[model samples]
Target chain A: TQLLEQSPQFLSIQEGENLTVYCNSSSVFSSLQWYRQEPGEGPVLLVTVVTGGEVKKLKRLTFQFGDARKDSSLHITAAQPGDTGLYLCAGVVLQGGSEKLVFGKGTKLTVNP
Target chain B: DAMVIQNPRYQVTQFGKPVTLSCSQTLNHNVMYWYQQKSSQAPKLLFHYYDKDFNNEADTPDNFQSRRPNTSFCFLDIRSPGLGDAAMYLCATSREKRTGGTDTQYFGPGTRLTVL
Candidate 1:
């Protein structure tokens, strides 16, 4: 089973539309992070949400951490073509007294012009 | 700009051949990590170094090896490349071990490996 599960494996939408991607898990995480990866490149850190029930906004993108720290959501307002990419969510999980970073399969977002 | 850099953006090797991928970071972070990412999948952790202290994942194949001679550079060695080993290899670095998820990891463009 995947430690983190991201919904809508793929998303295609028209420009200026709004959409949200979700990452869910059964285990609690100390921290959760969202990353955006462009084609032929590595993933880039978009935001990190640590505190439960916390909300952060970056430009048109908003990220929220679940109150239980087991889930996270990313919302994009008026998505543009430039926002097309793979959205990955990662979390820090403690196992055997050590912390490990786990990643979800990721949601491939495509915005049409 | 201080950043992570990977060499040989693309690599092609014959089956059973050995290949090496190099990563260097100017950020001088103490933690460097190597990840394997296949198409339409999440990046999988292969191994990492915390200032010469190597940490390998339990499932990482024996064919994979790594070396960190210094803080700025790390190398991933594939002892015997197979078709299944073909994937994008990503190198990343962070200021320290993530405790609160505040330490952001910086990644390189990645090296695409092809095994025939």
Candidate 2:
């Protein structure tokens, strides 16, 4: 079975601090996506990276896909309390002729003021 | 705006009681999915509908079933709600299925199920 492993399962940092979350996998994916989920709510898509070494920025959030398509990362330049939530990385994999997402365990981030 | 919606926001059921969770979408997308998310965990896809065709995940429990009676709505039925079944249920939709995960899925707020 293909699996995505996320590092720093829990992170707590002060406002204006920077942090990075890692998502690694042994299996190559066709694409990777990052999602942020607040408590009591479903996840919201932050960005999707399709190419190896691809990087996308959404405000202070930066997402990068590995050149091997086997890993990804999310970096926050200056996190605020509003950024506190769960960060999940999901990879698109073809299974039984159909494509589906395999998600990482996720990193729970708490940006304290 | 066109979006996915889930009912109740929160649901409570007795152990072994049957319950059905509802999902509706105004986006008129061709695909709808059901995901189970436990606290501090990633959303796990349970099943999905591509138009009228049903696709079940290999590991989804037999106690769980789903129905898409029409284009705008889908339902998830838990035959015997176990304590382990307590989790947030999310419904998402995509316009169409694409290779390499190009299809973007919009998610609803989710329904949190509590089993006692």
Candidate 3:
């Protein structure tokens, strides 16, 4: 089975601190996506990285896909209390013409005020 | 705004009882997915509907069933509620098949199911 290993399952940081989360996998993926989920809510899409070594930025968040397409990272700059949430990484894999998403256990981030 | 919607944000059911979770989408997407999320764990895909086709995950239990009556709506039916079945049920939608690429999924707030 394909699996994604996400480091730092839980993290707590003071507001304005910078932090980074990593997601790694042994199997190569065609694409990877980042999602943020708040309590009592479903996950919201943050970004999708397709090309290897591609980088995308949304506000203070930067997402990067490894050049080998087997890993990814998310960096938050100057995190705020509002940035507290569960961050998940999901990779898309194609098998026999069917595509499925393999997700990491996720990193729960707490940005304290 | 166009979005995915789930009904009965919270549901309570007794063991051995059956429950159904409903999801609707106004995004007019061609694909819909159901996921079960336990505390601090990743969302596990139970199944999905691509247009009228139903695709179930190989490891998904037979007790879990789904139906997509139309493009706008889908349903998840739990034949018997065990304590392990208690979790957040998330519904998501996407425009097309990923194939060898990625398709962004929009998710609903999710329904919290409690099995007593």
Judging by lDDT against the true structure, name the best candidate.
3
User: lDDT (CA) for every model shown?
Assistant: 0.92, 0.92, 0.93
> Per-residue lDDT tens digits of candidate 1, residues A48-102?
8999999999999999999999999999999999999999999976655445679
On DockQ, the leading prediction is 3
Model 3 chain B poorest 10 in a row by lDDT:
B96-105
| lDDT (Cα, 0-100) at B3 in candidate 2 | 82
Tens-place lDDT per residue, model 2, A1-113, is 78999989999999999999999999999999899888888889999999999999999999999999999999999999999999999998876666688889899999999
Decoy 2 TM-score against native: 0.97
Q: What are the candidates' individual DockQ scores?
A: 0.69, 0.72, 0.79
lDDT of 3 at B37: 94
Candidate 3's DockQ:
0.79
| Ranking of models by DockQ | 3, 2, 1
The per-prediction CA RMSD against the true structure, in angstroms, equals: 1.3, 1.1, 1.1
lDDT of 2 by residue, B1-116 (tens): 88888998999999999999999999999899999998877789999999999999989999999999999999999999999999999999988877445788889999999999
Which docking class does model 3 fall in?
Answer: medium
Can you list the residue pairs that collide in candidate 2?
Answer: none
Q: List the candidate 2 regions with Cα displacement exceeding 4 Å.
A: B99-101
lDDT of 1 by residue, B1-116 (tens): 99999999999999999999999999989999999999988899998887888999989999999999999999999999999999999999988875544678899999999999
lDDT of 2: 0.92
| CAPRI-style grade of the A/B interface in model 2 | medium
